[model samples]
Target chain A: MSNGVDNNRRHFLTVATSVVGGIGVAAMAAPFLASLRPSARARLAGAPVEVDVSKMDEGERITLSWRGRPIHVVRRGEDAIERLGEIRDRLRDPDSDSSDQPEYAKNEYRSLKPEYLVMVAVCTHLGCSPSFHPDPADPAMGSDWPGGYFCACHGSRFDLAGRVYRGVPAPTNMDIPPHRFVDDNTLIVGEDAEVA
Target chain B: MQNKSNQGGGTVGDWINDRLPYRQFVEDQLTGYYAPKNFNFWYFFGSLALLVLVIQIVTGIFLTMSYKPSADGAFASVEYIMRDVEWGWLIRYMHSTGASMFFLVVYLHMFRGLMYGSYKKPRELLWIFGMLIYVVLMAEAFFGYLLPWGQMSYWGAQVIISLFSVLPGIGEPLAIWIRGDYLISDVTLNRFFALHVVALPLVLIGLIFFHLVALRQTGSNNPDGIEIKENKGPDGKPVDGIPFHPYYTVKDIVGVGVFLALFFAIVFFAPTFLDLFLKPANFIPADPLQTPEYVPPVWYFTPFYAILAAIPDQVGGVIAMGLAILVLFAMPWIDRHPVKSIRYRSFLYKALLMSFAFGFIVLGYLGLKPATTLYNELALRFTEFYFMFFIISWVYSEPRSRNYYYGAFAIVVALIAVIDLVRDMAGISWIALLVMIAVTAFFLLLPAHTRLNESKPVPERLTS
Candidate 1:
């Protein structure tokens, strides 16, 4: 088989074909790529978002964004509810914890609402979020350690109440912030809703 | 043949300085290429598929320049592309729609391969490499879909990555590392970006090169099962093959043109990728605590989707799903026909081919709807038939060039092969025997020369 004309023919074909195909592809891909940016900008602005938590129930958690940080609003479960006393004794700073937390926010529950625990999910130890091991004996956080949060990060454990397990890399309990109820159910992050 | 001076020549031939060089040896093999004579339009699909992969990567890079891989920014950045950036909407749609188009071309390419027995012996390595590329493409697309962090992207990855938990020991940790956190977080997003933009794409490019080199080396298997290489006509070309230049170039353009028109329709209109059936919750970012009801995998994987949904929910079931994929890798080994096309085969072979084609379409459909206890479960087992039928058909059809004996043996094998297994599964081997007998008897009653009376030749190659 001989193709003395093959290379020249292939060249002409490839250039014309690739150009046409390339242009069509470039044109087709234009909008799909374009649709990816608006959200990036909205996220970069790190807007102080409002949460319309009207539909949330006693056990439901609502998540909202504030400063690109994920804020978890969980209605604390009963096991964590009953272990408050034991958690304080084991935590580095118990009752109202340390100066690092706000006074109004420092309660046995350490939250704006005793039922709703609004805290960032990130682990204080190296920044990995402790998984919600809400089940006991985790084999990860260990037995007799009632289910709470386990930072599969470096084995840091938080009690059902977010109090740090003794000897873990995380020193203080998961921080509960200063916040106020805006209305019956709605809540706002990054601002004191009560005063506003 | 042995030149002592050139004997030491390295790959570059410079190492053989005393006598000869290696470049000539390499160059000589690739020169004087000739395409087949009878080749027409069917050949264009392979090249078209290659074209799609190239488009996907180049457009993908453009998307990365502005795509921020963080949940906080992913959803919004997509929006900015539409409302803020200049002609950004077009680029974004191109990428999204381009994904669908990629699959369309690859499917056609795969089917073409199947018809011509392109996966046969000397070309097994080529087929395996191509299949591996197909697997990687699946992974790359799966991960790429998730970067948007939209509901589909979120739940899609969430569902797919969670499939790992089906495995023991490293299940939980593996899932975590894959997500790069307790759940899909910024870390996972960023790392996935690196892979999507740099790592996977690089590997994908390398594999594609291998795919073509292997394909060309084996030469495209022709429909007639003949190596037309040695039969070049006066034009110094394979009587059956054509140069991939002007003939294929002008031909494939029509396919490319139609594909682009459909792509623009999706971008200019349904940029959200959500329709009445697709839903809008997918537009919302994924929430970890809430698992969406009726979550479905992307459409391409629907065939196996039916199979997975059909099985009883247990760890064993998931293994079956994984096996289903690996099962495809064995396809080249399974097809034992001496002939490439079923055109010359006995009656039994044609029937088996028909069953497989029908089964494939059924499995794909079943993957789309919600799994049902009644029809879906039964359909699930048929998924096994989908593959078993292929092997059974091949094992029976080959080795017998005659009609009556081939048909009779196919039935005998099906009975002997599946009887015990069916009985054990249902405690009713008797019923299984009856069904097998009935099918075999039905085919036997037909005249021996039926297949030959109606078989069509392969369609022409390179249609304008």
Candidate 2:
């Protein structure tokens, strides 16, 4: 068998066969792997959500689902708006530099308008929604607790303006959703003010 | 090989045996297979693990019959199984309990390997196959957990899936790809169902086949850690070895009986195993918008979970958690000491092994609880202890390299102290400082300690 064997031809054939087989397997796997991604229905479900914000009072917060996440629309009072500036020094990202938000909402208040904070209520730590506690110095939140959202899951805290406090598990400020007010009574989430 | 005629003179069984090598295979893998006679209580867990695997597969098949794989109906389907389906509660609880028990038995089995140095030399491939089984089992459990579609299930999946997003560049896209949606939705649940029921189970069974093959190739490592094959008698069989069929099979049956007694007790009585197997919050249906007050992975995963929670940084936590599991795969290469078992090993090695096990249990306990300041601090210390075990094992692997061991100990202690100081420059923890000092002193003085209390010389023959 070893006499006058075409070793080079056999090697070439083996390599050619292997490469073709590899490509065939990968091509077969493509659609199956792609099938695991978000379907068309799931993508379409991520439409813009509009909420009526006219009835919301000072320090009142309402949670609405946008893209399967809790979008918190908080109508902050004069005291809460002032408190955001007061607690800027305690925040991890006071200016929302590293946090996610629209280009227009990237400010100290982390919103398009100063009085209304439209943010993703999910904790940046592990995606748990933080409960809104707007009152300053709430008894359960402690004496020096500047009114903020507190996550019971891992104890991450975000201030009234959605800026995360230092030394918490959360890495950055709560994300501000791309949102805008169509009228005094109407607010739309998932669409930017500039885009609208 | 030519077919050998049966002694029973061409009966119906002989006809089948002649066609297929069923009788030969049974004889080769079971009756003719030789195992060490000195396999003590620790050996029971391996067979028990196999038994639990069978239980899980059978019960899991039953579960899939009635279980709905959807975001909306999954929770309701589980409740329906518990109430409506005939003996469904028994099957479901058995499976849930079996999942926990599977980890329990596998953990003990791995510990048995550690104690007997089963991962050393020829058995390394066997150990690697076992580790692969463990990794696949974790994936199976993770995917199965999402099937319940409860609050804890949703949020736990949410947190764990989000961990992938902590990576730098492709993190976000990778996480989205995993979930099949923006969040844990119907798509995620359905894919997870396919993986849990089909993909991972097939992989697990294949890995188990390889694991058993590797085990047979190397033969079984016993409590004595001596090679039985080295001492064959006039009959060409190991004098200290027994056939696996009548001997070990009977012994394993006794183990299975006791295991099943305890297993069914939990299944019938405390299926949730005092809420450790199943969380209370899981009874409630999944709410995407509102996460439960506390979200924790099942108890089996708590040790690694604690390691993740101990690290303050997001990316750092994820990396540490990953390393904690991946480090186990390197166990075969880590301890290069001549001694194979704890019995003949130095007191320092035994002590280190015990401390490592203790730290693991402590980490597991801490992981289930809320991450308070004190718990987190303790968890960090234990996590340090966990990794230190491997380093210390390598350092003391050879007694001749005493000077090198000392240098390594100094570097390790200094590194720990520096990391502690850098992490908390504002206030240095006294507990961490003490732990660092104690660990430094212990390792630096290991040479003297080993000299005073020397390792017992290994005997050529197995001890009963």
TM-score of each: 0.61, 0.96
TM-score, model 2, chain B versus true chain B: 0.97
Clashing pairs in 2: none
**lDDT of candidate 1 over B228-276, digit per residue (tens):** 6656669766766666555555667886776667667767777545542
Compared with the true structure, what per-residue lDDT tens digits does model 2 show for residues A1-196? 3788889989999999999999999999999888878888878898999999989999898988999999999998887888788877777788888988889988878888898989999999878888888887688787877788988766677899889887667888888888888998899999989743
Q: In model 2 chain B, where is the ten-residue run with the lowest total lDDT? A: B1-10
Q: Each candidate's DockQ score against the native complex?
A: 0.02, 0.62
lDDT of each: 0.63, 0.87
lDDT per residue as tens, model 2, B135-249: 9999999999989999889999999898888889998888889999988899999999999999998999999999999988889988878989889999998999999999999
| TM-score quality measure for candidate 2 | 0.96
TM-score of chain A of each: 0.65, 0.94
Candidate 1: residue B247 lDDT (0-100): 56
Deviation in Å, model 2, residue B65 alpha carbon: 1.1
